[model samples]
Target: MVRITDEQIEQWRRDGYVLIPNFLSKEETEAARNGVFEWFSPSWDDYVAAGRKIDKPGVLAFPWDNSGLNKAVLHDDLIDVAERILGTKDIHLRLVRLDEAHLGIKYAGNPSNNSLPDVFHQDWGNNTIGPHHPEDFCSPAFFYCLDDVKPGMAPVQMVKNGLEPNPKNAEKFICPGGSLCIYSTWTWHASSEFEAKEGHRPTMWLGFNRNDRMWEGGRFFTIKATGTRDGWLRAIGEATPRQRELLFLPAVDDEKWTDEMIDGMFKRYGKHGFDPEPYRQAKAKREAQTNGKH
Candidate 1:
């Protein structure tokens, strides 16, 4: 696990973003790449070995059945850094995805090498559900490179000050595999056209915001979290407490954790291995302390 230094935190404050190289180990990166292939295309290894050219982009939204990607996204170190940037432990998980750069496509849906103006924009529009102003929302996000993103591999470019939306003034995020770039919804960033002749450029993106802000929400097109998706249930069942908390599950010590609620939750999610003992113990402790005090 990598620790975010004071210098990195200061850098984030000054530039609205920070890049940490080698944040994830080589082993971790390989696991993530394998996980992406497992979920996105099980035959990806064979395709790559055969030098097959892909015509379409590869994308998978959050709550998918990819444990490798899930571990990296919900990583303890990643969450700590997010809390530090967002200034709260009570954070909502906004987005998690596998965004790959394909051979003939660009970020904005134009064919690669097409004569089109570079598109640079802030994420606040989609993140905040079209807030009245960009300033009204702030969702800190992480872009983790699962592959070495060199020039022409669809590297993302962002304005240094997070203010300018010009292509000429943006800095490209060219980093090695296992690297991470932390940016916010306020940052102006754009993905470049994929120019690499072959191979894959896999990246994972995760975003979060303060849980208290109801107005600040997720991207509109992502699958609803409350749906009967198998991924949703798997995540809820298998996730750790810290991970579950980001999914809007109240902490064990939260005031809302009553005996009745605990029992209800056990009934609802018990089939998926949802353990209620933590909540049960917490409630018992709270009641015991209250009785003793009275």
Candidate 2:
């Protein structure tokens, strides 16, 4: 598993973002890129034919529909980094977006190749939720590059410190394929114009919030899935226990796990590894604490 260093954490706290190069290996990155292309090829057409707006070339709200993509989100390195940054093991997923920019695409709906404008802004602008504390960590946006994000490949531009738009101080996320860039939700950032001479840009995005803030509608992103609840459940059924935990599936007393859910867990993780005893013990301990039992 990849580990986050103290220096990296300090940088994240200071700059509101941190870029980790080569987070995924070459083989893993290629697999993700291929998987994304295959998944989006058919889904994009289906989504548009179903009367949905084709604002982007290949944008999937919940690309977890692909099993490989689902596993990528629960990557041990990513989970470890998220836990270190959030200072908790109980992290909740807020959203998962797959963006694919095909070659010869232009800004907006126009056919011209003028590239998109740069508009740095925070993501929490419209979210009126709790834990509005500016200093407190609300969410971390993770971006995984499936292609080389060079100078003109619509790389993300971020201000050095905060929202002040200082072009001289801005940093472009120019990294090779498989790199991961993690930024705070409050950070002021924008994507640069896609000036790449050739090839397409594909990226995997994952948003996460600390679990303690779940009371303010903890599972907000769950509703953002593109398909029905049953479809989402079916997709996640292929995930392992650790992956399901990242998806915030009920493991303890929050809700009774259906027989299918249990069977799926066993099928994916096996009986020896798919143990629910820890959750049961934790629930009992919580009850004991409430009853003043040491």
Clashing pairs in 2: none
Model 1 / residue 141 / CA error / Å: 1.8
**Which candidate number maximizes TM-score?**
1
TM-score of each candidate structure, all chains considered together: 0.79, 0.71
lDDT of each residue in 29-94, candidate 1, tens digit only = 888777666555433345555455332224366655555666676778888877877788988776
- Which runs of model 2 end up more than 4 angstroms from their true locations? 41-59, 96-115, 215-224, 227-235, 252-294
Total backbone collisions for each predicted model: 0, 0
Best candidate, lDDT: 1
Model 2, CA-based lDDT? 0.60
After superposition, the stretches of candidate 1 with alpha carbons farther than 4 Å from their true spots are 41-59, 96-117, 129-137, 162-164, 219-228, 263-273
